[model samples]
Each structure stands twice: as structure tokens, then as C-alpha cells.
Target chain A: MVLKVGILGGANIANKISRAINSIPDVAQVVVVGSREASKAAAFIERNKLVHASPVAGYDAVLDFPGVEAVYIPLPTALHVEWVQKAASKGLHIVLEKPIAIEDEHVDAIVKAAADANVVLFDGTMWMHHPRTAAMEAALQEIGPVWDVDSAFTFKGSADFLENNVRVKADGDPLGALGDVGWYCVRAILWAYDFTPPTHVAAHHGALFNEAGVPLNIAATLLFPGGRKARFLAAFDTVFTSKLEVYGDRGSLRLRDFVIPTAEHEASFVVATANGLADGDTRIATVEETRTVRNAVTQEAALWQRFAREIEVVRAGGRAPEYWPRIAALTERVLSAVLASARQGCALLPFEHRA
Target chain B: MVLKVGILGGANIANKISRAINSIPDVAQVVVVGSREASKAAAFIERNKLVHASPVAGYDAVLDFPGVEAVYIPLPTALHVEWVQKAASKGLHIVLEKPIAIEDEHVDAIVKAAADANVVLFDGTMWMHHPRTAAMEAALQEIGPVWDVDSAFTFKGSADFLENNVRVKADGDPLGALGDVGWYCVRAILWAYDFTPPTHVAAHHGALFNEAGVPLNIAATLLFPGGRKARFLAAFDTVFTSKLEVYGDRGSLRLRDFVIPTAEHEASFVVATANGLADGDTRIATVEETRTVRNAVTQEAALWQRFAREIEVVRAGGRAPEYWPRIAALTERVLSAVLASARQGCALLPFEHRA
Candidate 1:
């Protein structure tokens, strides 16, 4: 009953997923590692200690592997659309890395291909699968209608990373920070609003660009209907910060580590319910409640487990879940709008769904 | 000799300042309470237990009180210019409440009057005098050039407040939340950047306006030269939160209560120095250090003490300090630009110094 998974590249992120898959034996296991060079794939498997997985010379071999029910694509951003469509054509489900593609059209193409093949597709935003996320969602619901969300994910890149990382290269990542860290912020915001898209997006000025013209640091605000708004800051040029705060009419939720919890097994978020100010006091007092959740597996493993569960449902002749690809598409659309806004002098760009 | 201070209009905030003045008997003392009705002023004095201060029938009577050496003006927003001018003409040093005036021209007139009378002038942003502010500033320097500053100040308003508070009235505190809570966020941002004005400012959409068109909640971004930036969120419709985060190349500073210390005597901030992530890690490892400062006096008392020191210097024939008024003007200018940007469909407005 275990789902056999294939990894499509030797990217560093693949190491983490390989380890995650190795930890969850009953749900799923990575059985194949694919790369242009078999030796590189073997090295990746060895370094990550994936003893059960075998290395293959090319991605196509992984797609064609008889036992591979799903493929985890950690390929560079430029290679996503082609490989995802090919995987779909081969009837394999997908666990795609975030910033699923450089642009929305590519995402549309991949999504359409997945639909055509009736395959389960999910983006690898691991935090979305964490139990803490569910707890936060329940807390937000208790807080009343959310009116504001602020999130940030930033980390300082080393000199070598700035110079040679695929993220800073125009053809490699193209979207750079917006596609990498920004993906998490955007997804978290959307999740806070139950996958509803904002009506308009505006980039804040002072976006930093790499030599290849990809954004290295950026910030933007998303305005939804009914005065609901969200803002996010994503950067590869600042010290590490991963925080999200959601404000509701009656309360608020704040988490210091939203993208990745400080501990693998435990996560916490603070909820504050408004108590209004005491008589003649300048500040309003609130009861701050901290909620903590413990998980038996890492968030990445949970993500893999969820993907496997969906794949099993599809294998049983059930329809592929539409919600996964829908959110992925929405995340891509908002990111593209932010980039467009940044390029056009931080203008407010109306959100339009192309797919 | 202690500076003899006069209170104007009997605003609720004046009670805090009156207590601050009473606490520092060797430095300054409240001598008079002024209001349209002598009985109301007397009631305010009795309620606040200011036994040494006498109540005056009118604000001008407090200004003309022979022993009044200074004035603390907490009148409604629309009356700031007139009272400040009269206080200056009486050759009294002045401690004015924030949102010093509604517009740049009004601030210009106040600054001119203070200069013409050669009196010390300061805005009543009490946190500016806290020892923690100095400690945080020193830590920011160690963190290197600040490239980003984020601050927020918000408090929930009661039904009575939303309906009857002067802040929501068109003719009372017309600037509303921006003038009240937002002024603190803007001041903190400018202070973090050493009062260097940003090059441009833009308001985010979703600014909530009252029936009289006063902002109840707002967010904005300020872009400085060299890719440095600041952002602020101010609201009267959310749970209370006052946070400031400053990011630099090497480190960052985070304060949960930047506008007001949670405790009167002790305040703390966290500083994180980037150590670079371990190889193959997703986030940079940081050394988090928390710094705490203990103050013998409340921030309000510290503010009054600082004002007294400045008045002492001016009384000794030194010129009034220009830095105080200069920063006040800059904060107002940026606030005005944010309002302008918010009105113009969130357009990026170029920063200009009208003073």
C-alpha cells in the first residue's frame, strides 16, 4: 500500500525531501533519484542517506520507472513546465517545488496537463501541511473575520550564494526572491483568507535587484474586498526573519516562525483577543493565549504523506483534487502581479485570473 | 529653581503629564490648569490630585499667570496653532501634544513662534525619552546601516470611542488614527533612520475612513535613498499592538512594545546577528541577544525631565534646540505624503520638505 516516489533533480532541496521520505516508511518512500548525470544523483542520494532509492541518469527514466507512482520535481524553475507536463503525460502524480513556474502561463500549461492526465498535483509548501497551520486556521476563525495580514520571510545570502545560486540567475529562477521566499508568504496570506485572492496588488518601492535583474529583496501589499488587506516582505538580503500576523475584528494571531518552525516537532502561535482599554487607560488590554502543537513527523513528511494520500485516492478512480492546483495557480498569479507592479513603478495592478 | 508649567484644555493626556510633572518636583511642577470653565478645570485638578496647581477659567489666563514659566498644550487638533502662538508670545517654553499641527504650514508657524520667542519646544512623544530607545539606537548602529524599518501601533476603540471620541470627529482630531497612533509609528521609523527623511512615500489601499473621512486604519511605506525603506501600520480598530523591527546587513532589532513599554520601569528588545546558515540549511543561523533597560522614571516623566533640561539651557541664554522641531516637521511631512498617496489611488508620492 506504500506509495513509491521519484525525485526529478539533484537540487539541495531534494536532500531534505529525500530524508523526509525516508522517515515516513509506511506512507511513501522515494524509490528513484533522477538527474542528467547519474553520478550526481547517486551523490545526492548518498549524502542524504537515502539507502532505498536508486539513481537514474535522466528525468525521463524516473517518469518511465514502473514502480514510481508520484514524482517530486525539485528541478530549477526554468525546467518545471516541461518536466511537469511530461510527468503528467506519463500518468504520474506530482509534488512540485514552489514558484511552480516562472510565470502564470507555464503554471497554466502544467495545470492543464495534470488535468488532462487526471493526476494529483500539489505544490511543496511544506508548512501548509503542518498541524500548526490547521490550529492557526481554527484560531483565526475564532477571532472573527480577518481584516489584515502581514507576513515576512527573509534570510541573508552568503557571498557565494549571491554570486552563484540559481535563485539569482535570470534564466534559473527569473522571479528570484519573489518566487522563493515570497511563495511562502503569499501562500500563507491566501491560506489565512481561505484561498481567496486579493482584488489588487501593489509593490512597495525599494525593491532590490540582482545583476541579472531578478528581485533579491521585495515587498508588496495585497488589497482584498471589504477593506481586507495583506502585506508581505521577501528578501535574500536581510538577516533571517519569518513572521506572520493576522488581525481580525475581535482578535489577532501572531507567529514568529510561520514558514519553518524553529523546532521540527513543535510549533507555536500567539492569539490575542481584544479586551478594550480599561477606564482612562491609553492602551487597550488583551488576553494573550499561546497555542502549541506537536507533530509526529516533520512538515515536509506531512506534505509527502498528504500527496501520497491524494495519489491513492486518484488511483482508486476518484477525481483529482481541484483545490491544490487552484491555490498554486492563485499564488503564481499574485506573484506575477507583484513583479509587474514593481516593474511599473509600484503601481496598483488589478488582479486578473488568466486560467 | 523648578520650571512652573501650565496645563491647557484639561485633556485626558494632560493628567498623565501632570502626574509626570508632579513626580519630578525638583525639575518642574504644574502650576495651573486651564479650561473654558474654571469649575471643570478644578474638577480635573481634584481628580488628578494636583493639589499645588490652581485652576484657571481660560487658556489665556494660564498663559498670563505670572508664575507660569512653561505650558503643556493638549487642546483639540484645530486649536493647536492659536494656543501655541499665544503661549510663545507670553515667552513661555512649550511641550505640545503630538500631531503638533494638522498641516506643514501650521507646524511652520509654531516652529517660527517658538524660535521668535527663544523658547524650548518639544512634542509629547514620551517613548522618545525612554532609556530603551537610546539602547536600541546603539544596538542598531552595531547592526550596521539599517536598510529596513517596520513599525505598527494599533488599539481597539470601544463603541463609545468610535462614536464620541474626538479622534473620529471631523472638526476635533481630524487626522484621526493617523494623527493619534500613526504618529508614533512614523516617529519610530524616522528615529530608527536617524531622522533622515525618505525619498518617497506610498500608502497601501484598505485605509478605513470614518463617516467624516478620518482614517481609522492605514498602512504606508517610505522609500529612502540607497534602497533603505520603512513601513508602518496604524489602526484604531484592531487589538493593541506596538512593534518595531529594524533590519540591517549584519543583524536586526525587534521590539514588541516600541511605542510604550509594557512595564513602566523595565523595557527590552531582541537583537539577532546573522551567523550565516550551515551548509545545506534553509535558514541562516542567528545569535539572538535580548537587551533590557531599567528606568527610575516612567517614559512620561523622562520626557518631562528632558524638556526641563532643555528649558534650563534656554533659560541660561542658549538657543532653543532645532533638532526636536526639525524631526517633528519631518514626521508630519511624511505623514502628509502618506495621506496624499492614499488619496491618489496609492500612487508613489515624492517626499518634500515644506518647512
Candidate 2:
């Protein structure tokens, strides 16, 4: 059965998700495209050659659409939690394009709504499902235990975006650039380290400015438990660059262009052995399995399908409802601390996230 | 008359200083080289074709030389304070290389000795004296009011150094690899922001590994006051890379290679302006300034000579002897807090240097 998907905004991310849905096999079908501006929604539908497009005059209209099983939210950062909570209250599954909310309180409401309704709610973190990320994680396992990780994702963007975009203006905090990009980086480190979130967290926050004298770049460091740590550099006013390194006890894994890349497939591994602790020494390793990966968007759609299966099983009383709330709460907790550290200009120690 | 410079050890930095002294005009003369191992000092003297070379036991004889006016102490990190104090008490001018001393207590005694003896004490912070650094700072005036600055310097060595070197040997408390290269980065940021050290400091520390899975790699962050901050990364078991970036309101100046570059010269800067903010178009006005710096070591030596002159003038009633004592005390206080923050895994609040 095809799971019908509706887009609630005419933004770039929604358009990309819509395109990806069409490519997925028996998964998501783009049913309706809605926007506050009817002409914008019509143009987006016409551009994508979709059949249904409507003005988002009210939330009830999108929720009651025939065959609309899930809503893919691509609103501004400020509206994520409000829309997610509303959709889940109406028994609609949600694929939220993060950071989940402008504040942690909204994430709490969304978590409660999803828990009470027993509905599927997944944050849109497509990179988590990317093939390279999985490969990087598998490579970490080969190295035994991960000891440290370093990451950076920076790009040169306009000063206007830094000072006046949905980030600082709508969210009331300019450090969302770190949240938007650094979240993927932090999660990648956690995933590599077996989903262990930082027990103690510390960070230094600062911004880069453009010719117009506006803050357009930001960077931070996150300390995790058991001595595992991560460093992130997110910029909208510098050169374009992205890279990640995971250093383990036995070896290390390096990923260049961690977030986005357009070059030849380039990756490396360093192993520490009896001889001089491996210093970028190359070695031939055997590949035991051969597999192909779908495009990023298609893979994300597939993960959404997995979310649907989990939701269905739970609704049928085959799975416990407690699990989803924990993950949701954890996500909100981590994201909240990241922003708080940036605001406070110091590390915010992690607190217990009670569901 | 040429200023006779006697190097007390045949260390790596000593060799660099000898070469730099050769390039500068009417400043430094490599008159004598001495070491406990006579052969080591002889080899350095012969390799550099210096005028005199002797064993460490003949320190008094070398100091008695008519031309020996200044002593350049490039001993181990632990010996910085002792040698500087000894040289100052002997009525000889001193050029002390960083970090000055690993411990805060050592700084007070050393600074006092130099003051009482009426001798100049110059910390060999050459990168700040490099022409590109001057250009970067001068460009800051063009960029407008500075908001935030980020700096980094990272390199790789063997795991043995992590355990054996004074840098990571934990003076009283366990000091990670951060105390070595990390100090330079922290000092650079503090100096860039006019020595207003952060009231709060926090850090995330990590390790590479030893045979027994001990820490051999570390990275950390420091929060400074007025929204100024820094992050530093260093390892004894990875690759080598260094970068320093100063982001301002109107633009940013960056030095990709802060130190130890293979090329003859390294460093560059970029200035970007928002077009819309400038009253017209909806595009950014961006400009980049790129240039290669020359003779970083010699530039530092020149700065040292100027500092000597200033110290002489300041001693002639321009400034009180108490002025520099406060500066030295404040620097040590900052270093102590950084060490505490790294060890405790929490923000170390700043305090007045009582001693």
C-alpha cells in the first residue's frame, strides 16, 4: 500500500522531499502541496507536475485530505513543534524537518501529543540514513572502540541570512546555524559511538560577520561522556568546507566533505598497531559484502516507511509506547542544550530528560 | 655594536632563532652555543658556522665573553622560568620562548627577577609579529567593531610523547596535549581581544590512545568575556594542521597555517560586505586579500628588540614597574583557569591573580 505524503510548505526542502517520495518504491506518494500563499503553492505544484495544490487556510483541511497518511513539515524553524503537535493530536504521522522547534518547550508538547496518539513522528535527519554515514559507522566498528571525533561544516553565505533570517529573527537566536548543521554532526558522532549522548557538555560560541557587519558564522565544541568529544564549525560567512574524523583505540576513520560533496569518492582509515601508531598509512582491506544505496531522499523516504511500520506495530499493541517518547525527549534535550550553550557562551551540562 | 646572543641549549627553536638572527641587521649575533652534551652544542655551532661553542659546564666562561649581551633560553618547557630567572639575575637581557612557564607560580618569580635586575624579558611570540598578522590586525580597523574570534593549531606526534613530554605529563594535575599547542591558540585569541580574558572557561577533552588505551589526543574550548571565544585541538597520534580565524562585524581575517609551515610563507584574509545592507542590491560585496608572509622568526626577533627599547623607556619613568607585574599575573591566572577547566570538565571562572 502506498503511504500518501502531503507537503505543508513550498520551501526548497519540501520540494526536494516531494521529488524523493516519487522515486521511492511503494512508499510515499505526494498527495497535496499546501502553502499560506495559494499562488506559491500552485506554482510549486505546477513546477513538480503534481495534481493537487491548495492554500493552507487551516490545519484541519490538510489533516482531512483523502488518503493523506503523513505530513512532511518544511516550515521555518520556529513553527516545527507547533505543527508537529497539531498533526500528532489529529492522529497524523509526522516527518519533521528539524530543529524540531525554536525552543525546547515545543518539542515537549510534540512528544506528549505523539505519545498520547501512539503516532509515528520522525525528525528529518536524512544524513543519518545516508550510505556514507552507515559506512563510516561500520568502519568505526572495525577499529574497535571510538575514542574521539572531530567535525566541521562551513559555508560562505550572505550576512542578511545570519542577522535577519528565520534563524535569529524568528527563532530569536542566531546560533541556530550550529543547531541546523551541528545537530547532524553531533548525531553522527553519537551514532558512531553507539548512540551515547554527551553526559557533560561544554562549548564556546562566536560568530563571523560579512561586509555589512552582521554575524554570519558560528562554531562550538561538545564534550560527551567517557571522554568522547566532538568539535563543530558552522559558518555562513566563510569559505566552503566540510570534514569529519573519528579516532578510535585501534584505528581511525576520516570522512572528507562530510555534509555535502561533489568530488570522487575519497575516504581513508588509520590503524594503530605494534609498529608506529598508524600515521595515514594506507592498507588494502577486503570488502565482504557488496550493496548499492538509493539516493538520499529515497533512503529517507524508506526510513519514514520503517517509522510507519513501527507505528503500526505499536498501535496494534505489539510494541511498547514508552520507547518513542524517550527518543523524542532525548532529541529535544540535546538540541536545546546546544542552543543554550551558544546563548550562554559556555557549556551547558546535560540534564536528565524525563518523559 | 652588534648585540651578542648566546643560546643556552641546542634545541629545535634555538636553531630557528640562530638562522633568524643571521637575517636581521645589526641586531643579534650567534656568539656562543653551549649544552650539557658538548658534542651537541659543537655540532649546532659548526652547522650554523657560529663564532664560539662550548660545554654547559663552561656557562660562566661563556657569560664572561665581552660580546655576550643577551641570553636566548630555548630549553625544555619546564626550564623556561628557571633559566630566564638565572639569566636575569646575572645582569643579562633575556629572550624567553613560550610558554614562559608551565605553572603559574613560576611566572611571578621570573618576572620579578627580570624587573629587579633591570633587564628586558621578551616572550618569543613570533607569529604575532609576522607581517601578515599586522596586516590582519590593521584590516580589523576596516572591518569595524570586532564581535568574535576563533583560533586553532593542531599537529600529530607519537604516543610516546603524550606520556613522556612535559606538555602532557600533568604538572601536579593531569595536563592533556592541550597544554602544549593549545596554550598558543588561547594566548593568541586573548591577545587579539586586548587581554580581556573570559570570566568563564569550559572544555571537552579527548584522547587518541596508548597500548593500554591511554589518552594520546585531546581537543578543548575556552569561553572568553564579551562574546569572544576560542577552540583548540592537538594530538600526538594524528595528522598535522593549524588555522587561526578572526571574525569581525564587517569581515574576517584568517591565517590557515598559524605556525610550522613547509612553504616559505603562509596566511591570507577575506573581506565580505552585504549589498542589500549597503542601500541597493540584494547581493553580497565580497573581496579577498591574499599574501605570503616572509621571515616569521626574524619578525619576532625585531619585535623583541622593540620590546627591549620600550622596557628601557618604561623603566625611565614612562610606566611603573607594577604595571607589567599585573599583566604577567593576569596571563598566569588565565592559564591556570584553562588548566582547571580541562581537568574538572566544567567552566572555570576567572579570578584576580593574588600573587
Candidate 3:
């Protein structure tokens, strides 16, 4: 019942999934690694210790590999639309990396391709598969209804990376920081709101763009129905910071490493509930409790195991869980609105259009 | 020499300063309690056990009280213009409770009157006086130049408080949540940004208002020079949550009880610096250290001691600290821009006027 997976790129992130799949050979195994150059793919396989995987010359070669049941597409965001559709047409289940596409239409096209092909299409947001995410969400019920959310993910890119990295190339990442780290910030907020889209989105007035017009840093505020609000920021010019906080009427929940847990096996979130009122109205005490979740597998491995399950369902002629692609589409559409708002001096963009 | 202070209102906050001054008997003393009704003043004196203080029939009488060298004005926002000008004219050094005035012109006027009278004007933001505040700010240097800030102060108001309280009364505390709790959120961001006004400001699309057209909840984003950004939220319709986080290029510092210290004698902040890189491209570890500051007296008492010291300086024929009034004016100007942006459907408001 092992799913044979072909990896379509030799990107650095591919090393993560390769290790994950190899670690959980019973659930999934990497059978082929593909890069524009065969030598790079061979190097990747060796570096990640993928013994069961072989190198292939091109992306299509990986897709055409015999017995390739599913393909993990870690290609640049700009290439997702074409490759994802091609893989879907090839009848291979797909694990699309984050920011499935730069344009909204492309996201719709990828989702439609998967739906038409009846294959699993999961966006590779590793943190979503973490057990601690669910545990934190469960604690939300006790905090009353969520009224506010704030999240940020920022890492200072070395100057060389900024100059030579595909992420800063307009023809590649295009969405830049927004598509890279901002993807997680957006996804986390959506998850907090139970996948509900905000009513309106507006970027901060100071979104920075690289020389190639790729966003370097961007921040936005979203207003949902009932006055609920969320703000997210992502940048490539700050020290590493990943945090997500969802505040309800009675309390709040926070995690320092939300996009990626600081530790591989153990993750925790703090629940802050109000307590003792200081004698003066100066300040009141907050009762904080840290809840921890320990998982035997890395979140990436967990993601692969779950995607493999989806592949298993599809292989058995059953429908895969369609929620993942839909989540990706919703996330992309909101990101589109944010980027659009940023492009236009932070104009307000409504999710739904009405006269 | 003790500074004799007159209390201008019998509001709940009066109990705090009364106790603070009573505790530090040498620096300051509450000489008179004033209210519209002499009986309420008497009741306030009795409730606070102000043995050395006498009740006065009216605010003017307190201003005229013999030996009264200073005044604590915790009047609602709407009344500040008249009383602050009156107190300054009477040559009484003033501790003006926050949101000094609803209008920018009034804030300027209050500052002008204080300057003309050569009397000290201090905004009653107690947390500013905490030693931990200085400790936290000093820690910011190691974090590198702050590029982002996020702060919030929210408390769920009881139904009765919303319905019957001055905070929700348009003619009384017109700014409502913004003036009351939002003052802290705005001040914290300003503090993080080194008292520099943002280049532009924009509010979130949604701002809730009570029946009297008083804002009950608001959130806004501020964009500073060099692409640095800040966002703040304040609400009277949510559970108590006061947080301030200043993020720089290298690290960040956060306080759970920024608006008011959780403990009267101690406050702490967490400084998180990046550490161990996770094996995968997953999240790296963060090194967090909590530094605590323990004070011999409450922050409110510290506020009184400092203000009383200013009184001492003036009594010795020296000039008072001009930085404080300037800080209050700058905070008010930034707040004015934020509120203006909120009123105009989150329009971008610049701090300075230009072509």
C-alpha cells in the first residue's frame, strides 16, 4: 500500500519532503527525483539519502516515470499552473507546494484540473498537519468567539540570496515575500477564522518591492463580518520571527513558532485567560497555561502520510478529501486581494463584488 | 516639602492615585477631593481613607484650595479643555488623565497653557513610569532598529458598563475605546518607534460604535519612514488583552501586560532571539529570556513620585522636563491621524502636510 511519489524539482525544500517520505516508507516512497539538469537531481538524491529514488533529466521525465502514482511539485510558484495541470492530466495525485500560483485564475485552473481528474491535490503547508495546530484550535472554544488575530513571519534574506535567488525574480516567485512566507501568515489567519474569507482587505501603506517588482515585505489588515479583524505581516528584511495569536473575547492563544514549530517533535501554545485585577486599575494579571503536543513524526512526514492517505483513497477509486485544494484556492484568492490592494496604494478590496 | 494635590473627580481611578500619594507621604499628598456634589467628594475621601484630605463642593474650589500646589484631572475626555486650561492658569502643575483632549487644537492649547504658566503637564499614563519600561526600551537596542510593532488593549465591557458608563457616552468620553484603552496601544507603538510619528496611517475597514456614536472598537495600521510599520487594536467588547511587541532586524521583545503591569511591584518582558536552525527548512529555534524588574513601589506611585519631583524642580526655581509635554503632544497628533483615517473609511493620513 506504499504510494510511489516523484519529486518534480531539486529545490532546497525538496530535501525536507524527500527525507520525510523516506522516513515513512510504509506510507510513501520517493521513486524519482527530477531537475532541469539530471546531475542536480542526482546530487539532491544523494544529499537527502534517497536510496530508493533515482535521478531523472526533466520534470516530464519524472511524470512519465513508470509506476509513479503521485508527484510532489515543489516547482517555483510561476510554474505551478502548467505543471500541476500536466500532472493532473497524467492521472498522478499531486502535492502542490504553497502559493499554488501567482494569479487567481491559475489557482482556479489547478483546482479545476484536479477536480476533473479525480486526483488528490494537497497544498504543502506542513504546519497545518501538525498535531499542535488542532490542539490550539480546540482551546479556542473556551476563549469565546475570536475577535482579533495577529501573525507575522519574517526572515532576513542574505544579500546574495536576494540578488540570485529565484524567489526575488519576477518571472519566478513573482509574489515574492507574499507568496513565500506570507502564504503561511495568510493560511494561519484563515484557519483561525475557520476558513472564512474576510469581508475586505487592505494592504499597509508601505509594502516594499524589489528591483524586479517582486514584493520584499508586505503587511495587510483584513476586516471580517461582525467587526472581527486580523492583520498579518511578512518580510525578508528582519530577524527570523514566526508568531500567530488568536484572541477571543475571554482569552487568547499564542505560538512563537507557528509556521514551523521551533522543535521537531514537541510544540506548545500558550492560552492566556484574564485573572486577578490589580488593586488599582493599573493592570490585571493573566493566567497563562502552556499546552504541549508531542508527535513521533515530523510535521512534514505527517503531511506526506496524510497526502499519501488521500492518494490511497484515489487509488482505490474513491474521492479524496477536496478540502485541501479549496483551502489553497481560498488562500490564493485572499492573497490576490491583498497584493492587488498593495499594488494600488493599499486601496480597499472587497472579497465579493456588488454594485 | 510635600506637594499638596487636589483631586478633580471622584471617579474610580481616583482611588489609585489617592492611595499612591498616601503611600509615599513625603513626596505628595491629596489635600482636597472635588466633585459636583460635596457628598460624593466626602464619600470618595472616606472610601479611599484619605485622612489628611478634605472634600470640596466644586472643582473650582479644589483649584482654589489653600496649599494645593497640583491637581489630578481624571475628568472625562470632553471636559479636559476647560479644566486643564483652568488648572494651568491657576499655576497648578497638572497630571492630566489620558486622551488629554478630544481635539488636536485642544491638545495644543493645553500644551500652550502649561508652557505659558511654566507649570508641569504630565499625561497620566502610569506604565511609562515603570522601571521595566526603561529596561524594556534599553533592551530594544540589541534587537536592532525596530522595523515593526504590534500592540493591542482590549477588555470585554459588561452590558451595564456599556449602557450606562461615560466611556460609551458621546458627549462625555467621545473617543470611547480609542481614548480610554486605545491610548495605551497607540502610546506603546509610539514608544517602540522612538516617539517618531508615522509617515502615514490607515484604519481597518471595520470600527464598531455604540448607540451614542462612540467607538467601542477600532484597529489601525501606521507606516513609518524606512518602510517600518505598526498596527494597534483597542476594544471594549473583548476580554482583557494588553500586549506590546517590538520587532527589529535581529530579535524582538514582548510584554504581556504592557498597558498595566500584572503585578504592582514587578514587570517582565520576553526577549526572543533566533537560535538553532531546524534540520529541515522548517522553523528554527528561538532563544527566549524573561527579564524581570522589581520596583519598591507601584508604577502609579512611581508616576506620582516623578511628577512630585518635577514639582520640586520648579519649586527650586528650575525648569521642568520639557520632553514629557512634547511626548504627550506627539502621541496625541499620531492618535488624531489614526482617528481621522478611521473616520474617512480608513484613508491614508499623513503626519505632515505637503504637496
| TM-scores of all candidate predictions against the true structure | 0.97, 0.70, 0.97
Reference A-B contact fraction recovered by candidate 1: 0.31
Model 3 alpha-carbon miss at residue A16, Å: 1.0
Worst 10 residues of 1 chain A by lDDT: A275-284
Candidate 1, residues A149-224, lDDT tens digits: the string is 8999888888998899999999899899999999999998999898888899999877899878999999999998
Cα lDDT tens digits, model 2, A1-355, are 6677778877666666665676664665777777776677778887776654454544556777777878888787667767877787777788777666656677678777887776777777765555555666676777667766666655545567655665545333333555566656666666666766667554453444334432345555556666566666665554434456666666555544454432223223333222221211111121222222334343455456666676577557764355544554565566567556555655555644454
Residue A64 displacement (Å), model 1:
1.0
lDDT of 3 by residue, B70-114 (tens): 999999988988998999999999999988888888988888899
In candidate 2 chain B, what residue range of length 10 has the lowest lDDT sum?
B275-284
Question: In model 3, which residue pairs have backbone atoms overlapping below 3 Å?
Answer: B156-B238
* lDDT-superior candidate, 1 or 2: 1
Instruction: Assess the local accuracy of residue A85 in candidate 3 as a C-alpha lDDT between 0 and 100.
Output: 91
Q: Rate the local accuracy (lDDT) of all candidates.
A: 0.87, 0.59, 0.87
Docking class of predicted structure 3: medium
Which of the numbered candidates is closest to the native, going by highest DockQ? Answer: 3
Ranking by lDDT: 1, 3, 2
